[model samples]
Target chain A: MTDPKKTVSVKPDADQALKARNGRNIALALGLVAFVALVFVVTLVRLGANVGNRF
Target chain B: MAKPAVLSPDTPADTVRAARWQDYFQLLKPRVMSLVVFTAATGLVAARTHIHPLLGAVAVLCIAVGAGASGALNMWYDADIDAKMRRTRGRPVPAGLVEGSEAATLGVVLSLLSVLLMGMAINWLAAGLLAFTIVFYAVVYTMWLKRWTAQNIVIGGLAGALPPAIGWAAAAGDAPLNAWLMVLIIFLWTPPHFWALSLYISTDYAKAGVPMLPVVKGAKETRKQILLYSLVFIPVCLAPAATGLGGPLYLAVSALGGLVFLTLAWRVFRSDAGDAADPRVADRALYDVAEAPAAEAAPAVEGKRPPPVGGAKDARNLFAFSILYLFALFAALLAEAMIGIRALELPL
Candidate 1:
């Protein structure tokens, strides 16, 4: 028969892996957000001259 | 943010796993978003008003993001039913890949961002449509109509159908008659497309207790309704040509595709429910028999998984064709717009 204490002991490594994965995902998401923001800024700058001419 | 809990050095390795980034992405329903992007882009292009290319790209992106947001919110809210249904069991929330609350938070954040960006970059009208679409899908459809009515897809389809109108509004600052006509075609197409799928997968829905058309109306009525919707959908497909949105190319494709779509629906209607024999099964068995040596060949395995059966095959065929029909219709619209093709008009 398995010991209850031994069964409970397996959670720590799994918890650590979960934390690491979550951290990586959060970082990636932030990077994507920043990239989109950069694109928005560039587009505004590039199109500013055209906007004045068209209007 | 809270720090990770300190575990003893002897801690065991069986702890619960966290969701991967792909799991979170899957909550967005990227396949469905692709359809939204294509239809919306077609609408934008088909509009008489010209938009700056960069802004047009932004508008399409916002629409795609908004569609994704709606999908996430749907998965979050429908986690209960999703877990019960086999088809949706592996979805992020239901599969425990992402917490339901996390999905809801992502949905809300993306929804606000997409709408706000669209309003700033495009126009308020388009932004407003985007906001309404997200709410309609998340709250009106998923939370209310889906569980409450057998006509869920019929009504919920409006949310999916609105992207093209939103795109039109984004480009022209208002949707004209042609844009609305495109929306109507999608709205009519949705019932037949989804009901065909539901006919075969009714057992899954029955187990999930979702009150789909097949669950509530029975297969006979569902088939009849599918045929009716298909008949109605064909004329709507042709209407775009009369409105000058579709040219000769569009007319030809719509006419041929509509005929095939109607025929498949008719076949589905004629097939008896619960018929397990499929002609394809016989064809395959015959092929195997021809390939085998009489003395050395083993007898065919009995009770193997049967081929897709009578109504099931027709349902599957209709479902597959429905997707092709929509894509081809939209592609033709895109082609017409690009090439400056329009139907010839006769003076009355």
Candidate 2:
């Protein structure tokens, strides 16, 4: 019978891929934060006139 | 629902790591978070005499984080039992991608940070309630009542229902009767909502040695309890109309919803023990799985296994509908509030 230990192969290349994935994730997260901030600023600007009129 | 695990496959070798940030975001139970946010938002909105929108958003965010923290803590503590239960076996913790310690740490840190930030940003009343909610769910519900008693969900439900009141307190610095009315609606809603689920997964819970009502008591007893709780829930649900939170629209929808809910509960209660309730529910022998090893090992051949009663299909349909029932019921309330329809003066 084949060895059970060899059943799962976790290669070093997979680890390298994981590291690359992690880097991309960090960049993407920062980008999303920036986008959200930009949207929040825009919404505030758009709503400012209406809110001032209300006051 | 016993489909494939959401994250992990059977073979550990064939591990799929999602290369996106959204995948990590899914670790937070966003649907439950939304419900928490909605109820809290409704509370804050209702209580807004004159509050800044930014602070209100912060309050909602803190409540959302607190709810997420509780979910993470629950996943952390119940990881073992979750692995055994079919419904929860696919969760991140049980599926083995996320470590239990990591979940616990996230829960604890988030719990503290959310409450502390809320206290500093808002009033102390809301912060105190948030802190109590975290402890109640994580410590009381998760650590204590869950494994020990059939009444766990019934009593521990207050923790889940606190967010609205906490929101109200955040806005007004004091939760009055109207705020408590919101809490009561959810409190009464929990049993029928959860019991309907337990009706399906009684076997899984039994297998996991959780003393859920359906596991400890027979299905007949659980059904009777469901009917009893539902009878009480329907009236409490209408209390919002009296308390100025609901109007004609909410009253009409909630009354109709209550009738349907009662009908479903009655169906479950009336079902004979065997050859009923739907296919997903198999006939289970109600053994006291919570008792000590010595007590549980002794087989009570004398206590004959009751025949399965109730339409499992009916129960399953009711369980599914209960989720929508609560959602629709709350949506009606939101509709009424948004329309600015005031309640009639009820003859109390």
Most accurate candidate by TM-score: 1
Predicted candidate 2 versus true structure: per-residue lDDT over A1-55, tens digit per residue = 9978556556764775577577656866795696467446545754777999997
Q: Which stretches of candidate 1 lie over 4 Å from their true place?
A: A1-23, A26-39, A42-47, A50-55, B1-16, B274-301, B343-348
Local accuracy by lDDT, each model: 0.81, 0.74
Report the number of clashing residue pairs per model. 3, 16
Chain A TM per prediction:
0.73, 0.62
- State which docking tier applies to candidate 1: acceptable
* Candidate 2: tens digits of C-alpha lDDT, residues B1-348: 111233333426344343333423444567788988988888887663556677788788889988889888988888888777656666666675566776788688879878987887787899999999989988999899999999999989999889889989999999999889889888888998788777766777888888889889877788888889999999988877777777787788788988898998888777653223333233322221223233334564554533334465456556766776777767766666556677644544
Per-residue error for B117 in candidate 2, Å, reads: 1.9
For residues B50-127, could you state the per-residue lDDT of candidate 1 as single tens digits?
Answer: 888878888999999999999999988988888766567667676665778888998999999899989887889999
What local lDDT score does residue B244 receive in model 2, on the 0 to 100 scale?
Answer: 78
Tens-place lDDT per residue, model 1, A1-55, is 9877556555676676677687767967895897588467746855798899997
